[model samples]
Target: MSYGDDSKKKRRLAVIGVSSLLLVAMVVAVTVGVGLNNDSNENVNDSSHKSTSQVSPTVKAVKAICQPTDYRKTCEENLQKAAGNTTDPKELIKIAFKVAEKHINEASKKSKLLEELSKDPRTRGALQSCKELMSMSVGELRQSLNKVTDFDLSELEKLMEDVKTWLSASITYQETCLDGFENTTTNAGKEMKKGLKVSMELSANLLGIVSGLSSAIPSMEAFSRRRLLQDDLPVLGHGDQFPTWADFGTRRLLAAHVSKIRADIVVAKDGSGDFSTIREALPHIPHKNTKPFVLYIKEGIYHEYIEFNRSMTNLVVIGDGKEKTRITGNRNFVDGINTYHTPTVGK
Candidate 1:
């Protein structure tokens, strides 16, 4: 070949070598880019994991508060749901009671609705009892809620007592509502029992928490579960005639002899007192009072059922003797009356 043709061939060979180098560089760049994209995806995944691990402070507070409760899971979940940035124990308790109130009211409404479906007289009576008792349960829960909200540190002992009493009674009322269903051959009893189970459990759990308040509040250090659990409650004494927790009105009434009581009104089988029947004397007493009002009963086996409503507060009834002055009731479940309504004395 001539010298010019050989030079042209060398130029073409040089161009081919440069193209190979360029292709190699592009391959290296693509590999590096792919590695960087994978690293970026991994970083995004790490951030996502970090986000899921985070928890709300309010939820943390709820879990912590309900940790010691008997129904911890239920309490925690519900309180968490209703908890809106509240870290205050009192507010949490109030919220718990509010939740309980809602559940109890739901049970009450269920009882009424169940009543409409029941044809059995016993079932009807039980539903009626449940309706009334659930109302009482709601009232007691409200009382507890209010006390926790407005309680004074100076009166911590009384506050604990009142809260304990109210919460415990609410649980009892819920149980009593179910009790009315027993021995009946209808599905209503079972239904009501199922419906009321949660309400009762909530009340019980709240009572336990209230009983444990001494551990949480420094001011309640003087109170404890031991004092609350005494079998001899309405305690006669700590070595005295009566316990310190007894109200003045209660102490006075319990200590007083029949002769010492001045009658605001009297009931007798004989035509000697203000009225011949105890029922008649009920309306004569004041609808409300701050001081104790005494009603004296003369000796006789009176065939009557006595009842007092919520409005009749601070009233005392004294009988001549348990054996001599007797009150009798004719109500029974077999006679289509609820056992709740069968008591000789109902409050």
Candidate 2:
């Protein structure tokens, strides 16, 4: 071996040393990057797990409450949003009621659109009836809210009675609204029906909750004693004579003694009283009348159409008999007019 050979061996040793250092550096960088990536993935997964683990109390409460309802998914989704994080049963029930109120308000607004778009008198009349029914439902729901706000644990019976009455009335109003659209086949009618059906289901669910709460009330001796001491006794009647469907107020109105009740406006064909046609008497009555405004229709066939507008409140029309005091109109769907606009009796 000479000096060149020795120099070549030195170069080769230096090159090998440099190459080993570079390879070590590369391995270290790769290991560090892989560890960092693994840590980042673990942190991401942990964050996702934590978020999922923290389910809202209100969401659970809504799910539990709405589980037994007719519209479980609808009730849960709506009520969960309304309730936030509240888990209290009473609060949950109140939230459910609010949801019901919201749905009914939307339904009422939607039904009003039908009236505006209606080309037929009958369809308009039906839509008007739907609107009126929805309005009544909203009124009853408001009344229910008032009662719920005033609910007392001591006077459980009274509280339960008021709740049942108002909620039942609300349900009935929605049912009546759907009944108005029974024979409708139009797209508008279908949409109205669908909207009202959801409202009705929501109303029914609220009513069910009220009823369930009422049933859960403990029957203490005090409640029984109070009931026994009450002066106003339940009336007994023949099964066939008394209508099971009539409410307390309606029953009182239908009593034979109520015939003596004076009329606010009287309509007679012979011009014996205030107005000849029912239409003439309507305008005379005050708009947004708070008190009961009764109209007495005399026995005679009146060949005229009648409409009670939205502004009229608490207006009651009484006749001698359904057949004896009849109102007949010529307008119909076949007369090149929208059926909604053709009703002899419309709102």
TM-score of each: 0.75, 0.58
Taking the tens digit of each residue's C-alpha lDDT, what string does model 2 give over 128-172? 867777787887887787666444334455556767787898888
Q: Candidate 1 deviates by what RMSD?
A: 26.4
RMSD, one per candidate, in order: 26.4, 26.8
lDDT tens digits, residue span 110-164, model 1: 9999999888888898899999898888888887877765544445556667788
Candidate 2 residues lying further than 4 Å off, grouped into runs, are 1-56, 107-136, 151-201, 217-225, 228-232, 235-260, 286-293, 308-316, 320-324, 330-347
| Model 1 Cα shift for residue 164 (angstroms) | 2.1
How many clashing pairs per prediction, in order? Answer: 0, 14
- Candidate 2 residue-wise lDDT at 39: 61
